[model samples]
Target: MPEPPPTADVSTALVTGGSAGLGQVIAATFADAGYRVVLVGRSSERLDAAKQQLDTQPGRDIVTLAGDVGVREDCDRIASTIEDQFGRLDVLVNCVGTSDRGLAGELTADRLHELIDQNVVTTLLCCQAFAPLLESSRGSIVNIGSLAGKVGARYLGGYNAAKHALAGLTQQLRLEWRDKGIHVALVSPGPIRRDDAGTRYRDRTDATLPASASAPGGGTKVKGLPAATVARAVLACAQKRRTDVILPGYLRLLIVLGNAFPRLGDWLLLKFTS
Candidate 1:
């Protein structure tokens, strides 16, 4: 058998929403690649399961933090835990998100607010609380955004708005923290896939999902991507400290053309995406 490559002793990570979906893949990818992982989520059982799944990897530290990023104190508490245990955080992946579907006049203001808190507030809280730790090692932050924010998805109105805000936040943080030795990056991917599909975009909040359910836009039945592919995209951006990245090829064009002429892009999107 061939020998595997060696990993660096400096590798350490804190992944929000790391119990499932893309966050799960991100955690596993880092673990398999030999980074000590701090998995954050709301459910202790789910966190334990995720830790167990990666237990086969030796020389890797796995810490499960069960808390809400949406709450300020919870974010502080999680940060303290990381400080107490690891003393320094080398990488931080923000995968906390929520989605609500309503078309035209059907979406409510409350739902809009929920989506904002999920996509914007939670990320801000996490980044703010971890700034000190990330600065200690000049680590990077990888925020998983959505391409829908680049264009528009009709029924995903609130979701698109929240993610749009996240894109802006990504840029603001990257620039403001650049001289502070903290690298910030955003990875805007299209609909991501997982082997065991679950309630991914069910509501406008990051509420507890059922044991099993369909993914957004009936994607559960569609032939879709593997979570590992998205994980690799994240890895590429982190290794290079790129400002931002878009996946699945098609989305990148949309990002370019959309920014160049947004109105024209909106017309095309409504015409075709519908």
Candidate 2:
């Protein structure tokens, strides 16, 4: 947990998927740092839990709205509610995303589309509805990306493709919002444990004994960086208005290097998982 920042003006923030995992941690950071934090998520139970946790702070305003940003109506409704209540939004971090991991050819057309819609359409819609408020307040937007996006892996075709597309969206949005003083940045992360039923166990077991042979890092005894690491990266980018920040700095460096010399990435990924 981080100490609250010294600030007189309490800027408002809306964090999508703020009810759990990385989103929850990021929301806590904003609330602690003197922001009026609004958490958006699909689960009413989780949202209430998040709101209660955030409001426990002495000098904080925490709101929870149960809505899926993937839906346009939901995005519009939340945007309108925020504008009516807060007058301004200073930070918008989109951490709501879903991924379907399957080999490219194994996916049905519908599942493939769902993956794209879940990752790309959802973020685009949320940003679209909130752009006016962000532009007005010179707010910041952080999109969570992935190492898989930067460098594809076996058996994660749909997830990898959508994430790669998200990386593209981050770059384009930064350019579009640059002159307006609205910061837009991307945070690329290695896989982190998502808090769903048996997700952690499943990931660990699969990592140790992958179906498709052994990925190099697969057998390397890796723990996906904790979600807080991601929250920290988002915080750094938001505060500094950086164009891009990669989680676990070393992984970021490797991704960049992998992009230039793909074989190196392939070799590293294959060897470690094995």
Candidate 3:
């Protein structure tokens, strides 16, 4: 309800999984907003390409670091690199995550662990490594979450479980880190419109699942959000210090209704995806 926090003093921002997809877009968004942006990822080739793309945009300060944020040691190294070069970090966006395809009933332990590592552990490690810096700068951390985190969507394998864990973790981090002058937020968007949206899960979906299973959000009726829109929301959450944000703001009412009444929620979800 209060006006969003001012971002006038924000100087440097770091984004994990910044080489491609939503991460890259988030990095660009920050850079375009006049912040020095650092991108961390696993592949140098992809990082280089991302840097090149940002370079063509002109007037954007961008740095790319190759490292797996899911690894504690790698995160520590990344934190060190940022400290050495930038001297301070004002924002850290945890954008490293992977979506899944398959029925929850059919989900396997191995698969669930993999989902947690990719969707949750990576953010946890990054936050741990960057806490001191963020504290020093009174900075903000925005974890990119998914709509799956808010509700148990069907046919997403362990993704709903993984994102739900992330949602809980984000809240815990915000409460635990508040006294340290760090603001943590989560931006959970529905299926985002991307170049490979529908086909990315081709290999993971099968006969047991409907043809829509391979689509984004397991073919949820929600329209695909523009990646840029999601990026703007991330920036706003950091600047505004918002708590939990769901894309298509209207869905918040639906989410609340779903949470309060199980039968009605089930019917709504089924209708939306039918």
Using lDDT as the measure, the top candidate is 3
Q: Considering lDDT, where higher is better, how would the candidates rank from best to worst?
A: 3, 1, 2
Instruction: Go through the candidates in order and give each one's C-alpha lDDT.
Output: 0.77, 0.76, 0.91
RMSD of every candidate to native, in Å, equals: 5.8, 4.9, 5.6
Candidate 2 residue-wise lDDT, 1-274, digit = tens: 9956434256988899899778888998887777888899889998998888767878777889889898999999999988877778888998877755445766678877888888888889999999999999998998887766677766564777888889899889889888988888888776565545324334423343354322321223245677777787788788888887765677777667777898898886765453
Report the C-alpha lDDT of model 1 over 50-160, residue by residue, as the tens digit.
888777667666779999999989999998877776677888999999765555366678878988998899999999999998998899999998776666665665777
Q: Write the per-residue lDDT of candidate 3 for residues 1-274, one digit (tens) a residue.
A: 8944434344999999889998899999999999989998999999999999988988888888889888899999989987876788999999989889888787889999999999999999999999999999999999999889988888888999999999999999999999999999999999999889889998889777899989999989999999999999999999889989999899999999999998999998898784
Using all chains and alpha carbons, the TM-scores for the candidates as numbered come to 0.84, 0.86, 0.95
Clashing pairs in 3: none
Question: Candidates 1 and 3: which is better by TM-score?
Answer: 3
Q: Distance from true position, residue 192, model 2, in Å? A: 2.3
In angstroms, give how far residue 205 of model 2 lies from its true place: 10
Stretches of candidate 3 above 4 Å error?
1-10
